[model samples]
Target: MARPDIVELPLAGAFHYRPHPHHDHRGSFSRLTCDETLRDAGMNTTWVQTNLSRTKARGTVRGMHYQKPPFDEIKLLTCLSGCVYDVLVDLRPDSPTFGQWTGIELDGAAADTLYIPSGLAHGFQTLSDDVTLHYSHSAAFSPDHQAGLSYRDPQVAIRWPLPITALSDRDAELPNLKILEEAL
Candidate 1:
């Protein structure tokens, strides 16, 4: 048999993905983060905060959020238990992908991950009854610097899998992308 070569694909500006290998029984494992892999992808940022969250129901939705300038953070997110429809929107005015959005389906079984660069708003909808998501943020959480766009905004129509059964009051009240652009 011949060995398989590893490759990275650019999903969007500053966002990349590489297939990971998984071994049996002890559950699966993947090197979702590696200095060499990151270096090759040309993403030169350090992560400082790692967070994990588990959802109890299928219709859970979170975010469409990011921090403001000077505190804008870059992130890497992975689904650890079930699955989710991950969404990202470019908020960088000067970025070529500005105002554009991308979506990816990630599942624990698939071991897929998503890389979100700074100046993007991110959110996800649970695709399974119970799901756990993990993320690493380059900056510490700052409530004062936190900002977001409405997940249901028509300007960037994101087709979530289900109606959000629950959302934080803050997340539900975020302005739309158009409002965000006007604020800039």
Candidate 2:
């Protein structure tokens, strides 16, 4: 096993992966996100909501989504059921990671979690038949404040695990990364 490496990236969030202590075939245990843990990593947002999504197939892509403006939220995400190749793009103009992207492979067997700041775009593609994603948000959901970026945007250059096979009509129409930045 590899030692847990703390990754400090160019953004307004902090993240660290703690190895899960497995005792038997039953499973392992670890906290995905804790107030004190986040605080120590430079994230001070008090999670106000917990959301989960269950995807049925490898190609089930469901994001590049975020809340705009006053409803924008910081998110802490983890994969709890299967595995996924998660991607995040910095959309905050003032951020050092602006226009940059980072990707990680998250799975139930690992104690990996992703911390995404309020102004980044997030999405993932499942690597298994069933994927359950858990997330903590710093704000409430508001349909009117919802926004998204094109998962296929060439500028962002995210390498998805599979060709996008399923997406909502709304998600399909989101502007490309470049256009979204211009519109913002």
Candidate 3:
């Protein structure tokens, strides 16, 4: 597989990577990330941590979460199995698009990844059962720096594709944009 072709996403600092996967009788292989590719995009090439999550049920939503300054991080997100309706909300106070959001469908079979910049709260709804996601983070996690936004926030008004079947108690009670803006 060759280097992924990066496309600028609607949100400034966000990017979508379309990589060429090699397919043959033996199966397929794809390059999830490349240092030069990331460097060209002015993104952090050093990943401090890699996390894997597997959601068991469809229609379950996980996030609208971000980190505060000193721990805010860039992330490389990819769907490893099943599919998802991924979403991101701009939380950068100085950003022109602050309070705005964008959603994209990510298919597991597709060798694609999203370059998530700091100051963006991200979350996704599982489109199929047993969905797995991979995240490569530029900074280590800090409990004190963890933060989130409510999916029910009318201000952001995210139109999730499915009726949310499940959510963590914490995510359900997350504060809205107005409340988090000052801290973010």
Candidate 4:
């Protein structure tokens, strides 16, 4: 087994887990997550669900999404195949970096994961075809709690690497940062 080198991101509670793969005659292996490791790093450890996401085309954008109130969750997100430019915004009202955003390029070959704390909006732009992602969440999905800001929200102003090729109607209709704050 391998332990990931947990590097905290710019945002409070965000982290980048850089795993070192151990090589052998067969292949290489690494550990993605561990309770002891997470606990040592002061991260939430009670993951209740795991999910797999597959994106078939490059230049597709998904989210700027988060849950609200009692349903807010901590997420462990990893790129498993292909590449993506992952982005997130600090939506926590009292945080010093409130409304600020940050991004990182995640490569499947690196076998790394990003830690997203509660109250941050998370999204990604596929940088290669056939991208696969793994997600571990601390809470169950709740339609009523689901909310998002527009990917094109000028306030956040995310600089996606490629020209976007696809966006779902739901995402296209998400509200702006101002609306999110007012509604809260």
Candidate 5:
């Protein structure tokens, strides 16, 4: 596999990596994650869980979710099919970029991955039908530790590239940013 190109995003502890895929007559091969590359960037995470989500409709939104302390998680996200406008919001009160957000278009053709550190909220909107997202997490699932901020919270005010078409009942019920702030 060729060396992965890692770029730090504006938010501290957040990174974007593009793995070099080797093309052949049949197809191509690429290493999705490299410990050496992560080590060089000061990130050393042991992924314990992997998840796959398929969004069937364009404009489908999912997220603004995170795990609380003791179960906080670092997530490595990649789009396996179609495309999405991935979004992340810094939730660490002490962080210089707290409350700030960043969005990127992840295309299956590019095979780019986004590494989201703990203490951040994550979500995405599908730009095309049948989008698939793959995620690797440093921590296992714990429903009791899960929390979220409303994706449409005025305080976060994310400008989704497409009009939202669908949302899970749970995501639709998430507390607003003001409520999250009070709890924080």
Candidate 6:
């Protein structure tokens, strides 16, 4: 199998990976993930669940979501169709870069994946219609442990590339950073 090229992001434990895709007359084939490569990078996370999300409109925002300890998850996200501006925020209070955020553009054409470690918030905005995202998670979903920060919270202050055109009622009702900090 071909090895993936992993690029570390500014935030600790976050990575952008591009698999080595082989091109032939019919099409191309690539290994999306490799245990050896992940082990080499010290990111051998055991994924227990896989999820797929499809967004039909541009400027649609989803998440800034994470779960509390014991249920907090590590995610590997990839764009399956169309494009998106993926974002992540460091939520580990004890870490040096806590609350800082970074964004990356992912598209189906490039077939790159973003790896997000535990203790971080993950979200994204669709840049094109009919965008699809695939996720591999280390932990199972737990409603009781689920928590989120408002995507528009001033404290987190994410500058989404495009105007937010859509958001769920639950996401719109998420608490701000101050409240989250107090709870933490």
RMSD of each: 2.9, 2.8, 1.0, 1.0, 1.0, 1.1
Lowest-sum lDDT 10-residue window in model 2: 1-10
lDDT of 3 at 71: 96
What lDDT score is found at residue 182 in candidate 4? 86
What is candidate 1's lDDT per residue for 1-184, written digit by digit as tens?
Answer: 1122333323354453544667787865566677666766676548899999888888888989999977899888778779888888888888777787777778877556777878888898888888988889989999889999999899888888787887889888999988899875
Q: Candidate 6 on 1-184: residue-level lDDT in tens?
A: 5688899999999999888789999998878887878889989568999999999999999998999989989999988889999999888989888878899999877787999999988899999999988999999999999999889988779999999999999999988888888876
Rank list by lDDT: 4, 3, 5, 6, 1, 2
Evaluation by TM-score, superior candidate among 1 and 6 = 6
C-alpha lDDT values of all predictions: 0.78, 0.77, 0.91, 0.92, 0.90, 0.89
Encode model 5's per-residue lDDT on 78-154: one tens digit a residue. 88889999889989988998888999889888787999999999999999999888999999999999999899988
**TM-score for all predictions?**
0.87, 0.87, 0.97, 0.97, 0.97, 0.96
Model 4 local distance difference test score = 0.92
- lDDT by residue for model 3 (1-184), tens: 5777788888899988777889999988998888887898798799999999999999999999998889999999988889999999999889999999999888889856888999999999999999999999999999999999998899999999999999999999999888887765
Stretches of candidate 6 off by over 4 Å are none
TM-score between candidate 3 and the true structure: 0.97
Against the true structure, candidate 5 has what lDDT? 0.90
lDDT of 6: 0.89
Evaluated at residue 172, the lDDT of candidate 4 is 94
Total clashes, candidate 4?
0
Best by lDDT: 4
State in Å the error of residue 68, model 5. 0.4
* Worst window of 10 by summed lDDT in candidate 3: 1-10
